[model samples]
Target: MDPYGDTLFNEQAAQVACQEIAALTLRCADDQRKAALLDLAELLEACETTPGSDVLLMGD
Candidate 1:
């Protein structure tokens, strides 16, 4: 089995995305600053847990 071929593997990709958003938030202009900050906060909240398939695997 090749783990590198797995589409479900994230390797903390979401965390990386959040970090990029944070950098943008710091540099966002005044007009769009509030929205950018809100976006960063929302992404942070959504990343608190890993999402799983509704159907259980054979082990479950």
Candidate 2:
């Protein structure tokens, strides 16, 4: 599949992903994973660079 396909890349999807991440982080009781995830989040925030779209995905 073409990752840059129009239907797959949208602001709404990104907002949902961010919301899901916040929800999952709140529900998570695992300290290590939470820390890691938050750390990554912070690192991303600090970096001036960001991928154009769909840089990562959360999953099983």
Candidate 3:
């Protein structure tokens, strides 16, 4: 696979990881939300490394 393919996989994995982390965070205390948010941030960083012609920073 190419670098772009790898990046896509990484980004999807990061998103799934963040979703799982967020679900777990909801079961924990307020402090746990911070850690979950951190995980989501890391996922965003990974997603940023992916190159594409139609990149989105937000949805309408």
lDDT of 1 by residue, 1-60 (tens): 643443221326555656777777778778577696766556554653456312111221
**For model 1, what is the error of residue 9's alpha carbon versus the real structure, in angstroms, after optimal superposition?**
10
Q: Candidate 1: list runs displaced more than 4 Å.
A: 1-11, 33-37, 51-60
lDDT of 3 at 40: 62
Q: Compute the lDDT of residue 5 as modeled in candidate 1.
A: 48
Residues 1-60 of candidate 2: C-alpha lDDT, one tens digit per residue: 545543332344555555666777898899999997776555444332345544343332
TM-score of each: 0.45, 0.45, 0.40
Q: Which 10 residues in a row give candidate 3 its minimum summed lDDT?
A: 51-60
Which residues of candidate 2, in runs, are more than 4 Å off?
A: 1-10, 39-52, 56-60
The lDDT ranking, best first, is 3, 2, 1
lDDT by residue (1-60, candidate 3, tens digit) is 353433333555555656766667667767767786776666565674665322233322
lDDT scores of the candidates, listed in order: 0.53, 0.56, 0.56
